[model samples]
Target: MSSVPKALKYSKTHEWVREEDDTVIIGITDHAQTMLGDLVYVELPELEFSFEMGQECAVIESVKAAADIYCPISGEVVEINELLLDNPQLINEDPYGKGWLLRLRPFENDFKELLTAEQYTKLVASEAH
Candidate 1:
């Protein structure tokens, strides 16, 4: 089963976000990494890159397939995980922790479109079929 931490918010594209102070941290869900299978490459966004919610911000290539990562909220990217450049498999080992992709200083606090843990659980369950 995929881990869906209750404290974080999720996107339909299978990304998760955790708000911290003025920024929101973004990463793929456990289900995403499992579907992709053994990530081999990660293309991270540049710092200070501005993006709208649902915009394509990064890419991940796994042994099975390549997937585009969408920004969960509108903001300017302030930080990216440098560790993933050499260790993309961190995403498979720890999807919610050290595998976090980027941090964005959001444009606003409107997170009405994000899903709760319960909602995401249902989403994953529906997709299982």
Candidate 2:
């Protein structure tokens, strides 16, 4: 089973979002890291770069293959995890903590469109079937 922290909102694509004041902290979920296997490299979006919801903003490459990381909402990137440049495997170790990908200042009022923990769990379970 994959770890899904209840405090975070999730995308069907496996990104996690944590609300913090006006900004949202983002990261790939444990399920994502598990699926990707051992990570080798991470391509994070530039700081201050703006992207639309569902846009492909970065890439994560593992020994198995490369996977695109998508934006969960329209926003401007406020910060990125520079440590990943040195050790991308932090994603596999602590995806919800030190492995966080980026922070974003949202363009909209609510992130209600994002999935709740229960919903995301169901979504992942359905995918397994």
Candidate 3:
């Protein structure tokens, strides 16, 4: 099973969202990284670029495949993890922490509509079937 932090919200596409002050941090969930295999590259969205909820805004490439990472909420990107440019393995090693992909200033508080950890866990289980 993947590590699903109870505090963060999740999306059907497997991105996790963490709210901090007025910004929201986004990253791929542990299950997503596991399925993709060892990460070799990360393509993050441009700073200040706005994306609607569910729009593909980034990409993560693993030895097995390249996956599109969707924005969990409509927002403008404010920050990105520069560390991933040099070492995408951080995503395979610690997906929730130093591997975080982007930080966004949300246009609205629609984050409340995202899935809870338990719901996401169930969704992952269903996908395995």
Candidate 4:
């Protein structure tokens, strides 16, 4: 089973969002990283670049495949984890923590429409079958 932190919101595409003060941290889920197999590279969006919901904002390349990471919400990218440029392995190691891809200043704070931990868990289960 994949680790799905209850406090975060998840997208159907596998990205997770953790809300902070006026910003939200975004990253691929642990299940996503596991499926990707050892991350080799990451492509992050430019700071202050705005993206509409569902826009492909970044890319994650692993030994198995290169996956496009979509923006879970409409927002302006505020910060990116520069550490991933040198150590993409962090993603495979701690996806929900040190492996976070970027932080965004979302256009809004109401994330009720996104999937909860339970819903995401079910999604992952359904995909496995």
Best by lDDT: 1
What C-alpha lDDT, on a 0 to 100 scale, does residue 49 get in candidate 2?
97
Clashes of 1: 0
lDDT of 4: 0.94
lDDT of 1 by residue, 18-129 (tens): 9998889999999999999999999999999999999999999998898999999999999999999999999999999999999999999868899999999999999999
Local error of candidate 4 at residue 21 (angstroms): 1.2
Arrange candidates by lDDT, descending.
1, 4, 3, 2
lDDT of 2 by residue, 1-93 (tens): 998889889999999999999899999999999999999999999998999989998899999999999999889999999999999999999
Segments in model 1 whose C-alpha atoms lie over 4 Å from true places:
none
56-80 in candidate 3: lDDT tens per residue? 9999999889999989999999999
| lDDT (Cα, 0-100) at 122 in candidate 3 | 97
What TM-score does prediction 4 earn? Answer: 0.97
Cα error, candidate 4, residue 107 (Å): 0.8
Quality of model 2 by C-alpha lDDT: 0.93
Against the reference, the lDDT scores of all candidates come to: 0.95, 0.93, 0.94, 0.94
Candidate 1 achieves a global lDDT of 0.95
The segments of candidate 2 whose C-alpha lies over 4 angstroms from its true place after superposition are none
lDDT of 4 by residue, 53-112 (tens): 899999999988999999999999999999999999999999999999999999976587
In candidate 1, position 101 carries an lDDT of: 97
Worst 10 residues of 3 by lDDT: 37-46
| Cα TM-score of candidate 3 | 0.98
